[model samples]
Target: MTSTAASPPILQFTDVSLGYGDFTVLKDITLNVARGQVVALMGGSGSGKTTLLRAATGQILAQKGTITAFGQDISALSAKQLQAMRQRMGVLFQQGALFTDLNVFENVAFPLREHTKMSEIEMTKVVLDKLDAVGLRAAAHLRISEISGGMARRVALARSIVLEPELILYDEPFAGLDPISLGITAQLIRDLTNRLNCASIIITHDVPESFKIADHVYIVGQGKLITDGSPDQLSDSTDPYVQQFLHGKPDGPIAFNYPVTPAFEQWLQQRKS
Candidate 1:
């Protein structure tokens, strides 16, 4: 008999443990993302945000529990099945990761040409369409290195969405971005998720930026989810760790415990005195 779970989540992690061999960074983590929602995974440094991001895409092998993406066990998939699963998701790396050697058009078209047996003319049309959607069509012929950081991210976004994925994972998409770029990227995320009716997961510490786009938020501390809620609830939360991190305080729970080197301490003291 098939084990039936009523109304299973679109993405579910049941007591899932993750990390490298014999070392678990995230332990007994449980969460579910409903369809058409954006979830932000917030945390400080070393909070296992990257690990969870990789787990979502099946890039990191789960040491325990089950990861169900689109209603199937991600661990049970064969190579072909995994490839098929990955195709349904779009991932934007923190660095944008566009190929420096390739021009923007080629970079965007790479996934389509690799995954599908489309003709060159068909591939070109698809690439152009996606680039235009991200407002980078005019720079299609420019080399990756030629574009600014914001343009590079737009190109990366164009490439990720070329296949029209149902899930998009952004691993710190806002880092190193100028205010204008950060605003654009945030809007792009909101627009694309709404337009495609796909779920989005962003790992970031920029609370305000995440608040602008996230329908739901999850906070990870010391490799565990300390809390999960809507932006308003999180903003009003009095949890010490949550309060400290969210308000960017200097003497709160996280800051008091953060390691300070002797050199930096001496420097700070000298400046104050």
Candidate 2:
């Protein structure tokens, strides 16, 4: 088997640190997602996975180091250049983020309409084809409120892929799904990456499902990358943080309470004064 490492990376983060203002969430991060591979970004609630996504899309500039997408440094891109670069990428948000006023077909067709001048007939074919990939082609006419949460998520997936982007970012793709829906979604993510020959980065907390589909996994906590490896390699890891995250251990290197930072303590002291 040819290793995925031999594949060219679509996204690369080198010595990266991300934050809002003065509060840094992640630091010294280095990771890559190659073509045709699904990389899982696993972490707890406030562990900066979303911040990395923001940096990837150039919504926020990195505090340090570089984020390279498709071999172009994100920070160096001009505004127009960044917009062009974004056209090659897709994002599936945590809540599906479908348009409430549009029907299923229109929702999926939104990207094609906004980005391409394809005729209605051509757009119809493309929209149906993407919906079919997610097993929701027949729900084309249904309004957003008419579908189940699982079905809505699939519709969002179809919409995200409608442009056939070279890079896809999924934020909590497996969140709030029943077992059957979760399984179907996981399988679809794996199948779509293969079919599109694209890179996928899934920011999720679901371990078993993500492990089953991810080509590589990165776990983060306490403002840094704890570890990264293949699912099997992570399962065999002896690191307390890795073991704690993978097995859902209550007691380990990761504590229950959030740490009290010096900045936070200083603020508290000022309040007391």
Instruction: Please tell me which predicted candidate would have the highest TM-score against the true structure.
Output: 2
Worst 10 residues of 1 by lDDT: 1-10
lDDT of 2 by residue, 71-110 (tens): 9999999999999999999999999999999999999999
Cα lDDT of candidate 1 equals 0.85
What TM-score do all the candidates reach, one by one?
0.88, 0.96
Model 1 clash pairs? none
TM-score of 1: 0.88
Q: Tens digit of lDDT per residue, candidate 1, span 94-169?
A: 9888889999999999998788999999898889988888888899999987888889988999888888888888
Q: Supply candidate 1's per-residue lDDT for 271.
A: 100
lDDT score for residue 245 of model 1: 87
